[model samples]
Target chain A: MAVKDTRAEDEQLNRFWYRYKKHTLSRSIVLQLMVCAVTIGIILTLYPQPTIDAWIVIGLVTAIAIVSTIVATSIAMRPVKDLSSALVHISGEPTDLTPPNINDSYYSRNKLRPLLKQIYAIASANITDAEAPKSSIALPNISGQLNHTSTGIVMMNQSKQIIFANSAAPISIDSNGVRSLDLIFDVDQPIMEWLSERGEHDIHAEKSWRRIPNKLAGESERRIFDIHVSYDRGSEAETIITMLDRTGEYQPEDDDLDFIAFAAHELRGPITVIRGYLDTLNDELIGVYDGDQEELFQRLIISANRLSGYVNNILNASRFDRRHLKIHLAEQQLADIYDVIADDMRMRAEAQQRLLSVSFPPNLPTIAADSNSMSEVLGNLIDNAIKYSNDGGSIEVSATVNGDFVEVAVTDYGIGMPPNVIANLFHKFYRSHRSRETVAGTGIGLYITKAIVESTGGKISVKSVEGHGSTFTVSLPIYATVADKLTKEQANNTSLIQHSSSGWIKNHGAFRG
Target chain B: MPIKNILIVEDDRFIGEMYVRSLNKAGYSVDWMVDGNDGLIAARNKPYDLMLLDVMLPERRGGEILQILRGGAQDLIPGTKVVVLTNFDQTEQARKDMEQYADGYLIKAEITPKKLLAFIEKLAASS
Candidate 1:
């Protein structure tokens, strides 16, 4: 019975709409004809003795009158047309109806006020039906799950004001009772930047930040969070940021370390092939090139060498981070190690228009260190000197004996660091803000250099004056001093002596000396 | 004996060709294999003076081949020297295991053609 009543009401509405449109159209046509006649009558009055030009003027005025009347009629009938379409749309999809305000004066004085009232009644009923299930079932369930989830979620407006924050969000309300994203995240976090940069286009971005909050409930631990930011572009623009705590869940061995090692290993193969080809080319093409061509070939070899060094640095840095890097300290001739790398260093320095000079005192003692690691340390220091120095500035590598340690210093007359920059120089991924733009570096070179130096019971320090120059000094324990200490600690420790005789140990006499 | 005959087992064709060209230029007979299976077959078939084996290979790993050749009841070719040349940085245990069966282990990235020739010449002179 209800369905039949609805169908009858719809049919009546359609009939009323059709009749209203016909009445409006006929009225518009009559109004336009009257306007045209009046305009022609005025034109005729202005020119009683009508000539061909006067008749033409009357015809143009009549045409303009007809057009203006049609436009005005359409403008006046727009509200009634809207009402008819609103009714049709509501009948088709009642749930999407937006009821008109009955209290508005326009609707009150409208010719289709009854139709508007009918649509309003149907709209209210359908809206109630649509909202009932959502309020009863989905709202509570969503809020409950959001409150229980470990991951913190926050939604913000374009101004970065927190619109909605879940229970897991580490938020604090200010005295004004306003909760903001600033209270939950640090100022350095990229989430705030992302929110501020929100545009009409959608954005999806993620970053990781390490945070250490104050003790809460007697528990204080370092937490690493991977923050995900998503922006939705629409009339109601919003940004959603989610923070997933990855402190306990992060497994370096299973994830990024292995990937770094794998990638570095794979990269080494190609570098080897490239270097091999370059070497063969150098051998076969020796003495066949002019000065400029030879310089270019030399630069090519230097770049290949640098690439190989970067791969090694990445692998070693990953290994050092995991404490898997093994440094077998033995008596190593510092001269031999330096000699192996000096030619490459010289080429690198010359390529950049810098002079490199190596000076070592004769009869220098061997140092107790890993030859490969020592080479890396010296290479990193020299590479830094070459990179940081200005063109034509000379870089000097020299050694000095200081007590029981042999200090190898790499000095460059170029841009240097201030005390503040030097303070965090050894920290991993800490590149000085001043040099970050002008200099190209991975920021892990010094970190790995420091670790390797310390692992071998050596020390690395730097002295610099901003805009003048810098000097990096690495002091390694003399081989005899370290060996003596080891022998005193363990008289039967033959392994140290035995290990020192392996390859690259050119000075066996240093053990007895 | 001087290293007159050499076998190179490398997957990368460019690197293999480089080794072959350099070694052949230096008047050493060379056999290049692109995979571990062919390499092992060739090694078992004939006794080359020196075998340049790569660690990461298809069909069989350099470590497995080394174990099969050296861990057998009797040596396949008693005096043939095997040098493990690779770019892979093995773990401590894995390296130790491979080092047990190989005469020498070298990083490929650290050794150029000239350096490898020098190393081979030194190995030949020592033997």
Candidate 2:
């Protein structure tokens, strides 16, 4: 019966192709005759005089051209007939489907060859009812590939019995032939809840949980997972749950920052002890040391201070990375902050044999800032200036009132950075190749400095020329203006300060230094 | 109202000893506790003019101790000024909560022995 049906289908395909070719040929011939008639008429009109012999020659040439055009059209369209037959055969029976061999020169030059080959390849690959058993052989291969995947897959039937689970799945069959999701996940887990709530409906749901403490034996660290659940509530009801472990993907960067914060915290105790003892010795043994010894002692203190600054930078940078850096803004005098650090700055500059001068305009406006963090910012810039300068060049620390803001510029006659280096100077861990060897730095000072300045409603910028010098400027909002804005915001019942600690300023009298 | 009697609640031996030596040499009697529980007990047993508290400590945290002493029905040390001295950085909210009970907050690494002594003396004179 199948053979007879195939023969009948082939005959029908041939009949269809013949009718298509005949119709296309008749249309082409009629179109050619019309063109010939129009050309002859145009010639008669243009010359207005044509002999009988010239007319006969024109008619003969036109007839030959028309025949040749018909032949060319037929040849060009032969590929279509071949393609249609191939498609009919492919659609008829899988067993009888044979892919067309397009290696022949005729087909190789035809534009439809690639398309014909693609259809034949697809038809041959398709499995019909007779070849359905062959697909069973592919089931293991698919399961194997799924097993190799990192995503855990669990498929369950309507009765809640796990039908299939990949090796990555956190499930196991019990001795009593019981397999359930509860064996792997807690009953109250969000995944379980999601499954129970949405498993009976046709839907797709996705959820992600972060830093879930590992409950497995002997494992102390947390794990992150992204879960996707797809359910089909048809006659063959089933639910597919996929879990992707994202712990390894997110751990390295987080671990690095945590380690930095931990290490910085640990370093602070030793730094405190060292600075304390050094200062104690300096206070007790004053005037006992000779000039050179006193200078050496002073250098020791300076180095200790620099160490403390480095630790602060590491801590702040780590905190900034975790989005945990806190700044408390209040009215602060720039001169008061400078006065506290003037001695240290002078000693640092003098130690380098470079003159350090600071100038602040009289009646300079007070700025809104966290005094401690602002001190760090200024210290970092000055330290950079002292570090990068060639011996004996001067460094200037100056502040100016620029409309409702104060711009504090630290300029140094140092080996300034090129534009390329200056562009990446504020990026974390970005060190210029030129200064990496000659200078000792963690490359995080400027980053932390910029973070602190900007977090307190300010901006930091740099101007540098490779051979000349670099000036780092910090612009901060004036206190009265910030206070005025804050008061207005408070009256409007809007939150003026983003940082929680800044709320202390509500009782402004207590913070008045 | 001189800060002659002081309480130093610090876990690190070296840091605690440094403060004790500096304050003692500066003519103030210093009581140093290495554990948070011991420090709280000492604060309750005797009155101190000033208390230098470390935030992270064994047995209990300085913040917890401060909350207990200050948030209780009775003020254990009415005139004692509490200062949080630690290297551990606090969040803004934590610092704000601490500022309510703390007279001062200072980073231990940022202040030298001499500076700390001077600061305590100033607090003493002001009080």
Candidate 3:
């Protein structure tokens, strides 16, 4: 978008110059002719009578008037003429808009000086805006910081030329400011290309850390620099591209996720086999168990199964805490998810003597979500509602079509939380004072839920009123790949519950406490 | 039709034996290979119904082996449904690469033999 805006501005500047040039030439001719006509009329009025000698006097007067008019027009137009030539100079080498050598004449100093300065300011401002939208990032006194700091600092103009270079900048990149920074820094490869292509730079939006390989003096040893790029739209530095050497500290080879995964994978194999064998025993596929033995084995198997769930949650929570959870996104129809989850949740709600109400508006947009994560998120919220709610309290799960987002809210009319408790609900290992005593929880569910929600480019929020139930809303972005053309007719029916796949749509079942 | 056969490519002997026993009990003809190289060779030779590949192996990494199986580095068993099994905390890089080719992904310690059998049975029934 920025690049296209720049090209448009450049074309506009060029067209303005073309029109200005033609208008000046035509205006000059008209002015000269007017001057000659007025001078000739003045001579005729002064003579009053016509004779051969008088006619000669008139001819001389007209000749003198034409000569003086031509000279005066040239003199007056000279400054504008110089300015046009200067504009052409500035346009050709626009990236570096420094006014160069010019003829010092009577009109050059006073007229052209301020005008040239004003035009330069406007062109620079336009180009900077083209580089990046007026950045909301607050950058402090960069020049002062650069002088005191040891790290290399180089600020680039719109064309990627080093406009301001501290002494440390050249030493770090091992290149003088004589060449385009691309030769020394590798922003043109991945960082700049991704920004131009995708309009973002961060690996994640929270941190602006990007690794750009620094081309050392020789290709023998590879050196890397971790840089955080910030665009300063207003200040002298149009784009502050800060480089910090990360060759010593950042090592991809030493990442420990593989090791942890390996250990976890190793632990699962034994656990799976043991659980399978236990299931077989419990099923009586083995020799028939005696009454007392069967009871003991059942108890053992139940505990083991519960242990497995705990282990899985703990392992998953470790990743979520570190923000290392991996999720695969696809365009998934919400109807399929609702049908699957609601079927099981209905049974659970009925067992607890509570009512579970589910409603889905028709033509619901598909969300860009990992089905597994979606299942886990929905499962967590529903399970929490079931556990936290009082007996016979109703739980409502509804899917509403929000603009550019699909909101799946689970509102339970159970034991609602106070504001102080609700504030710490999403924090890891934060158990409410009321729920901690009554409910059994690890407090990792909401933390994992929040992480999964954010990674999908969405948000999860909660609203609660003390003595009433709490509402937990998970908002997911509509998958861009899917064609979800919401029609005017569909928009009229805010509750299109009767329209979507009816397997789980608008199901209302109440159970007696 | 012939029996549903599967190749279990895992380095851990304990895990390899456990999967073999469960797969056998589930009525699958299972071939267990302890090394990634041997697993790759076995997969190339036979049309196994499914392949359980572990990331870390003695001869080759599980990712590299899957790459060849999926026609990335080399195409060996393009039609074979592979399950990339790893134990560590999830990594975005591995999942993004392996999930493209694999039929399923599992963390072994987190999944029991019955769950593994359930996956195999589902894959077998679908195929």
Candidate 4:
């Protein structure tokens, strides 16, 4: 529904029909005209009728000719309709999206089949060629210019054969000129596994490095190098992969991150213990809570959940800093995600005397995302909205289709931020100087949220005015997969922390404390 | 089937106790060991329905224990289900080792007592 009708599609379809028709002229109309002449000639030769009778026969034949022309025109253009439908499936999706097979009729098998292939090839090429002008990025100095710097430059063809490799490169081939990265880099994890994941990425886009212990480095230490990729995806041309040694960049941070990760997990132990005992105490085995004790229990539950959230944020921050944040992307339901985040935060919002609401079009498309990461993304946004807003200030979370993306917006009319604060809201550990004193936060929430949104091929931005409100919006590419239910357990969430999607489990027996 | 008995190998008393209580509440016989050697001894002596093994232990890492149970000549508790509990040290070697031997790898900070019980129950049922 986000894709409104466009003149470009109509024009392209018309162009396709023009190329499909064999002759320049309207063949169907010409054939109908020929048939009319033939019928008239036969009538005249068979019956030399008087003027009135001849006129009646001629008029009837003329009408028949018109009807025949209409029918023939439709049949001729039927292939056009079929081809247009095929292109529709191809237009908005990747080249691998399987277009409908052309019907195996005589007209289709020969005519439409060849045309469909040609059109598909053209469309896919056009998508890549749109980037061809941008692919003019000068290959980072391949020879003498790059040799001076420690950065390793390696250009590889579609088969991943090394076309060029500097001596200083992080990876190298043998005397036999072996091309596979597996053969060259003595790494615990395959370097090609990292390289092969980003073939369709647009020009100049860089994927994160796969930090693995390099046996080749001779130190048994983890070697880090980003794989800068440049390739014309439509062609079998070489993908230029440049390895910039970032091991030095994050080497020192590792010690701090290790401590941070362990400290966060250590904190998580107490929180979990506290929460577990609370849940057990509230269970049927323990005496039911009195009227006032019920509210007290709720407050305890909220605080425990908050502590867990803070610890998880620290863990996420360290994971991100250490480049251990693994986002497993799949098609995910936005509606389900919105529902889960809202439901989990509802009690917390009520505790703070604020309203939390979620409204999305019932038919919002599934987005290409990491489900758990996306939950974190939305949760962080809503959390900030609730945290910054004044008591009783309503928070609204809504999503709408925007072009090829689903635009999710979280609006809150709380204590709004100034221009300066809004600018640095996503900076690592960037708490507003004012909020730093008043609010309790790890300050890594927005940073992690932004990283997640961007890595999933989405964008996050916020607009706010001081003392009014803020609207944080995230735009995610719509995935074509079906909606899936939010289960409490996930393959990725096989960890010590409860996944945000699992917050709904609180409603299950003895789940909520 | 009768109650499934579980053995938990963890160093932290708080987390170990939490898992123990939660698993007990779920109607399973649970045992906890704070040291790697003692846990391994218990694992080899008794046929547990499932084992929640932590990677960082006193004498031996959980990965080593799993490797012994899975590949050693003794093949102690070969049929027992083992899920590795990881902490901050998710180095490539540690990750690959766990993946090589353990049935599942979960982070201690990412999982809770209730969630662990759910996973234990799932493994118990499947076995």
Candidate 5:
């Protein structure tokens, strides 16, 4: 029975040597061949002489062969132990890496003893560290490189070690080091389970996460992240954890409940006044025969129209919020639109005893824009200027073409905006805190104007002082083409030709045309 | 001057019909045109003692028609006493900026039909 057991053991050892020989030590194969060659030479050099010295030399050759064979076997098996312990280190599992009968084997005193000792030491060191907090793991240094650069690697493992983090990660994680993955995201069930499970998770499926705290510009806020889980292919128990920061600025959704409430509030007063006027007009309490009564009806109509303008502005602002505002691009003469708006507002300006003036550099290029929108924009600006101007102040509308861009400025010499109000003037429903007492405004005109201008790929900026006036400058790309000018000229010629033909017909007695 | 006939030019059908109904009850012959173009055609085709003109018309806006008349585009409608009706009273100040255009300016929203009838009667008596 002992002989059969020894045979089975010998078979296992032979298989193990063949398997790990290439991975562990193919270099020892050449060493064994050289040792065998020297042994054979020593045996051949000693003839079959019946002498004590010859016998002694033969004994030395046999001992050398045995020692060389033992050295080769130990060299081949050392790395297998190391590989097994590495797997155990990653999994947090106790590994049985001791070679059977290794201490009783002939190669126990070989150089491979030290390698086996190191692998055992490494595996045993992790036994007590099983419950070590992941946060205490060695963290990488990642500071001062956030805004301009990003490292593309992300890592998480079952060994509780993570690596290759950029500057934003430490700040994002909100801890000194990684905590238990479960504890970090325990609020999100799917994410916690996904991190524990050693497998890749689809970001769409595992998107829920615990909110991480962040401070931006002295304000505290929360950041969200999407964790992607992956496992090391070489070992099933090992895992990789990666976090992606999905945080961005807050853009309020249109149709937000608060925004709708704001809209309703804005329209309520104007609509009430309009409805009241209509009721009075229907009642006709003023008798039919007075000349002054005719004038009163006219004033009612004017007020109704003014109220209509406010409603239209609110609707436009809502459209802007929805991102549904579309620009109708057309080749339009900027100077002509400016002239019409300035001319339209001139009377109102004068009514307040304020001055309104417009100037255009001669032969300024025509801009491609929606004519109605341009007129509306200019009209609102000029009207606001007139409304906000002091009794004796002036409002100037000026435009000039400069290097492929046209800059139009509306300057009002009136009570201007403070820095805080000016900063938020383009925000929806933001009324100038200063102008609230002095002016009657819906606070939507400038917001709508900015939206319209930006929708056309133009930019608007303002400069203002508290007690002086504000200057709003709009810079639009000039889109003047030779073809457009030619077409315009052709249109003018056609109209002129038509006029001359009509004149000729009238003079030539063609039915008195 | 007998106040038997009156011409009304208004773009809005509802307002024009209202004017016609109100003027006919006041014992004046009323003819209504829906726009400036038709008004010009009707004015040349007949002699009316008074013409009520709306300054903002749908087709061929009232300002264009006025420009044609004041610039000698038509002779038969010459010196027609025109009373301008507009939704925007500020437009009176605007119309004044135009030379030799509207004879008089009236706001539609502020006036009642009865009041408009009296004003027309007075103008007719003066003429």
Candidate 6:
């Protein structure tokens, strides 16, 4: 819609220029001719009357005036004729505006072709619009060239006021209104400026908008859109944005899902038989075997565990993509949850020669969070930190309580991220270029973490430098029920600060109750 | 340990038969059932040293069967050890269920027949 509107505006500006140029040139020519005529008339009036020589000079002047008038009239009418035909074409009645038998070779081809194409498209588009007032025309819209399409389209002014919005946009905004776009769309201020400046330069931004806060009556809605923006050529002032509903696009291909399900179903049998064989071998219940056979059995066990992990990751990602991921919430201490996840991941961290450390202050304020979800979030972050960090690098987890909010920071001394990637750190399937080479990441961990954190009334943010390291801070609202335990003064003064000295342990102690 | 009766409870028939063959080749008598209900009935009808149970089974679930076996009816068998074999690993629910019943839980893809036999042998000896 914006694209079409912008194109129309462009045409109007073009017509204004066309008319302005013709008028200015004609006016200047007429002024020059008038001045010449006045001078000639003055000369004739001043001279003695009725001599033959004087009559000859007068005839010569009159002949010159007649030739100049014809030239001026023809020159002026040429553009006027072009304008008339252009206007007629624009108003739904198409006519051949390109003059017949005009020698195109006379015009400079290189300089004029682009301008001519622009003029032609603009003129033709308007003609189609006027011709078919009710019929759909092939003109660019927000999506670029919409022909009977239903995509949510929105246009906002500088004031953030939604001026021209489509019905789909309103439906998507739902009860939350345009205010929701402001909350979720986290493009940089400079990017917005760039969009405005470039006008129609395509931008690839991954924007995640929460499904409208309030639901439509009785519609069990579990849908969200991840819009990918690209530029479409239209006008210079307004941008052209294209959105792809990623939820619809990212659902695993049916073949993959079926394969996984079938494999899992088939795996049960062989595994059962394997377990039985292992039991027989260990018991010497079966025929005696050598140490090599026992070692092979051990290898089989390890392979199986690894395969299980892969299958689980695939299944989890599928659930998350489907938006069927759910978290069970309960009142819990941040430090305690950290301890559990840390312990669970400690062996893995040690096996990789990386250090994991955690810290939290005593008497720290409690937050209402689901322990399982929190564990998953922490595990993912810690795992990523371990993966990206150097072999002997150190990782730290700390918590600080700020009134109603508690901030949990996970800092890793690793190969940090670039500014480009730090901005899109939480986007799904978004991986840093550097990390892509060495690390095997699904790129959905941080996205899942962000979703889990936000769904529980908590927010996660990242701070990083390319070479130094990265710190991910999660801010969660302190549990409301526990607020009454502290007086106004104590509540204001209560703050928890913890620092980890080494791997998975805080010098300030594990957690403050 | 040389010659004994074993019961295999699994939803997939192919897997159940494979277990039966492997255990039978090991010189131990083996009984197989496709569902938890039939497995439980088999356990009641005959005495068995160990039972290999699949976690997700039709008619009755492995967890339900574990509860019944661990309940007052355990006097009927005197001493029966069950090991839960399942594929859903790393999940909190699966972990919780593993901790709840069975001597030990083994993910289906992770354990081999020989290693499984070792674990069962250990369980039998310890009992």
How would you encode candidate 6's per-residue C-alpha lDDT over B10-121 as one tens digit per residue?
7776566656666676677888888878988998888787778887788887877777777454455555666677764335564444444555555554345544565556
Measured by lDDT, the strongest candidate is 2
lDDT by residue for model 2 over A221-264, one digit each (tens)? 44444566666543122567777777686556456756877888
Q: Report lDDT (CA) for all predictions.
A: 0.73, 0.75, 0.62, 0.66, 0.56, 0.57
> Deviation in angstroms for A23 in model 1?
65
Docking class of 3: incorrect
RMSD of 2: 22.6
> Candidate 4, residue A440: CA error in Å?
3.5
**Cα lDDT tens digits for candidate 5, A103-193:** 5454365544555566556545554333231332223211222222322224444454553444434333436765433223211235345
Model 1 regions more than 4 Å off: A1-260, A484-513
Model 1 TM-score, 2 decimals = 0.59
lDDT tens digits by residue: candidate 1, B8-125: 9999988898889889999999999999999999999988999999989999999888988997898776768887888776777666666456766567887788878877776676
TM-score of each: 0.59, 0.61, 0.47, 0.54, 0.37, 0.48
lDDT of 5 at A24: 42
Q: What range of 10 consecutive residues in model 4 chain A has the weakest lDDT sum?
A: A504-513
Top DockQ prediction, candidate number:
1
Question: Rank order by DockQ, top first?
Answer: 1, 2, 3, 6, 4, 5
How far residue A490's Cα lies from its native spot in candidate 6, in Å, is 30
What ranking of all candidate models by TM-score puts the best one first?
2, 1, 4, 6, 3, 5
Backbone clashes in each candidate structure, one number apiece? Answer: 0, 0, 11, 12, 11, 22
Q: Mind giving the per-residue lDDT tens digits that candidate 3 earns over A1-513? A: 999777757654345545665676567667767876787688678866778987787678767766776677666765665566566554553433234343445436555666766655655665565455364221332344356444556676655556676644533343453643432321123445533443334322211444444443224344456666666434445556666766565333213333443365456656766665676556544467765776567556655544554455555555653445555455567766565345446656766677888887888877876665666678678878988898889999888877889999999988888988876677555688888788998776787688778776778999988878889999988876333433332344322222111010111110000
Candidate 3 similarity to native, TM-score: 0.47
lDDT at position A272, candidate 6: 50
Q: What CA root-mean-square deviation does each model show from the true structure?
A: 17.1, 22.6, 21.3, 27.8, 22.8, 16.6
* CAPRI tier for the interface of model 2: incorrect
The CAPRI classification for model 4 reads as incorrect
**Predicted candidate 1: what Cα RMSD to the true structure?**
17.1
